[model samples]
Target chain A: MQQTRTVELGTGLFVFLGVVALFFLTTQTTGFSGFMGGDAYRVTARFDNIGGLTTRAPVTMAGVTIGRVEAIEFDPERLNARVTMRIDGRYDQIPDDSEASILTAGLLGGQYIGLGAGGSFDNLRDGDEIYLTQSAIVLENLISRFLFQQSQEDQDD
Target chain B: MSVLRELGESFVSFLRILGDMALFLLRLVMYTPRGLLRFRLVVHQVHNTGALSLVIIMISGLFVGMVLALQGFDLLARFNSEDALGTAAALALIKELGPVVTALLFAGRAGTALASEIGLMKATEQLSAMEMMAVDPMRRVVLPRFLGGVIAMPLLVAIFTAIGIFGAWLVGVVMMGVDAGSFWSQMQANVSGDEIFEGVFKSVVFGIAASLIAVYEGYRAWPTAEGVGRATTRTVVLTAVSVLILDYMITAALL
Candidate 1:
């Protein structure tokens, strides 16, 4: 009788668990719509060194993600990496002469593109290239430069 | 001349230690997953290490979350970035601190216990008797604890991380006066499912490594109480070292 009761209880427990697992598995996704919102216009910006420029990396204007990098490609002639970005439609008035610099999110962190909006009335459109682009400040390069300068100073001393 | 000879001796000793460790690891990996006996042993070990450590982890997690929110509130308010508290807390807690610290704590608490238990079993000749009885001690004993630790370790880490975020919310809303809605909403906005999966993946691997080290040391203990004691001490030390090393390697790979 006890064994029969235990078996029944176990069956009930398994059913309960199956229900809970289903709920958790279904609930896990929560839809991926907000992630790919499209009130943004896609544009291209090229850099000599995009160092760690990941897909979906932020494109910033005044440190806000005006858009995100949609894709990255290499240009052998200009010796640069081109970042294609999707920027918010609201920021369409940004001048064509605006500077785009590849910036670090924080010290020793991910790379992002920063747009310095110019006052020129001529604004950019899709497929128009951002001309004034700055490459990422390579950290190792900077450290080596600093060390070389210091050694030069030491030699003079 | 003496220094060179001493260096030579140490190098040979190191190589011998490495060979032993490699052989043990190879044998353990090969011998695992034989049948039900092996499976049960793994589950039992995981229950001991993981289920046992849940209370301590939860309490620690809860308080830490609250304190972080409070501390972060003051700093963020100075820059008017208080709205970002939840995002910051979730990213920092889930991505980095959650798994690493929990693993360290678990290593100290349960890893020590595993080592001591196995060491005692070895010192008493009970392990040898099981071997003589054709019980296959690896399947009957070691594999169970190793597998159990691996399974339980990740689950425990997840529990700790969840409690921590909840704790952070409690402190953020009640103490620091951040709106609860905003906190949760920001968390939803920033903390990706991928990030959470990555953290869990790391913890699972950490669990397997930690359990193997602790259990292996204990299973091979010398036939003395002192030897058993030595094994426990080594387990804690080795587990902690290995956890830190693995954490660095994973972060580098992810980056």
Candidate 2:
């Protein structure tokens, strides 16, 4: 009987540890905390080119993640990528005129949308679109354009 | 004529085993609603499987994580991105390595024990004795073990993943001079819920496969010592192969 009690206690502790680990893993890995806490709002942005931007990518405001990219679609009439973002409710003070730029984390890290606040008192609400947007800077395009310009200059010389 | 006869014999046996396994699974499921009422028995088997298996799971997690950190750091050095070592290790452990390794370990550890224990009882006629007493051994013995294994597997995998990340941190931040802040922050920023869910889902499927095979093999083992050994071996082999195949299928579908 004593042995049984000890075994049950041990199993309980083991299971508890496992649950804690899983909760830590879930919170650490994703923007799930914001969604699970029910404290996020949706907004949209339009860029001329999103490059390799993917759905579920983090949306950061001043280095801190506010939420994630919910979806990406092509706007045929505007000829650009339309990105839907979910921002945390706690950070609701984002000005309506704020700029959203696609930025890379490091030299080879993944790209995310970063928000630079504007000086306006008007705040962004759900479904509101941020018009001031910059697309991902494709290094290959810049390099090729630079090469083309140099060759043109050489021909003129 | 002999070669053809042998091929035919093997194929027939294969189908027979498959049929028996399917029926065993059906019976197990049928017993579940009532068997679940025996919570103490399930807890006993949990002790037998989960508690006993913790040491091995933790040891494997640590070593796998250490190896990942070392190898990842070497590879990332070329790109001058050693800071992503934590992310690489965490992602690998959470997404693929943790569940796969834990399931393989469970097959070798708890799975074999389950098969052999039931085989021994059958050989000793204990199961039959229970039947004579009007007690269904399938519910009293088999169901508990099955539920125990299924419950134990995901917990084991969770522990494996957590320990693996810590191991990676030890090797990356404590031993080699990588920035601790970057390692964790990058891991946090890149690792997502979908990847974690992928691992959890894989483990659940593996748990079901491993436990079902273990109990099925045990219950059906020929009532002999040698038969018990063979059944145990079969449990490990079948569980490992199916887990790998299922891993591939799940990863492909999820990704």
- Best candidate according to TM-score: 2
| Collision count for each candidate, in order | 5, 0
Q: Against the true chain A, what TM-score does chain A of candidate 1 give?
A: 0.74
Error of 1 at A118 (Å): 21
Tens digit per residue, CA lDDT, model 1, B70-125: 88888888887676788777767776777888888887888888888888888888
Look at candidate 1 and tell me the lDDT of residue A66.
Answer: 75
- The TM-score of chain B in candidate 1 is 0.91
> Per the 3 Å backbone cut-off, how many clashing residue pairs does candidate 1 have?
5
Native-vs-model 1 lDDT?
Answer: 0.74
lDDT of 2 by residue, A1-157 (tens): 8988899998998888889878878876544554635767899999998988999888989888888899999999988899999888888999999999999888878999999999989999998999899999998999999999999999999
Per-residue CA lDDT of model 2 for B104-165, tens digit only, reads: 99999999999999999999999999999999999989999999999999999999999999
TM-score per candidate: 0.69, 0.94
Candidate 1 lDDT, A7-116, residue by residue in tens: 44543443343344323322331223254475778788888888777887767898766777889999888877888988878788889989999887544246878999
**Model 1 misplaced stretches (Cα beyond 4 Å):** A1-54, A58-68, A74-81, A84-157, B1-11, B35-38
| Deviation of model 2 at B193, angstroms | 1.6
Poorly placed runs, candidate 2 (over 4 Å): A28-32, B1-12
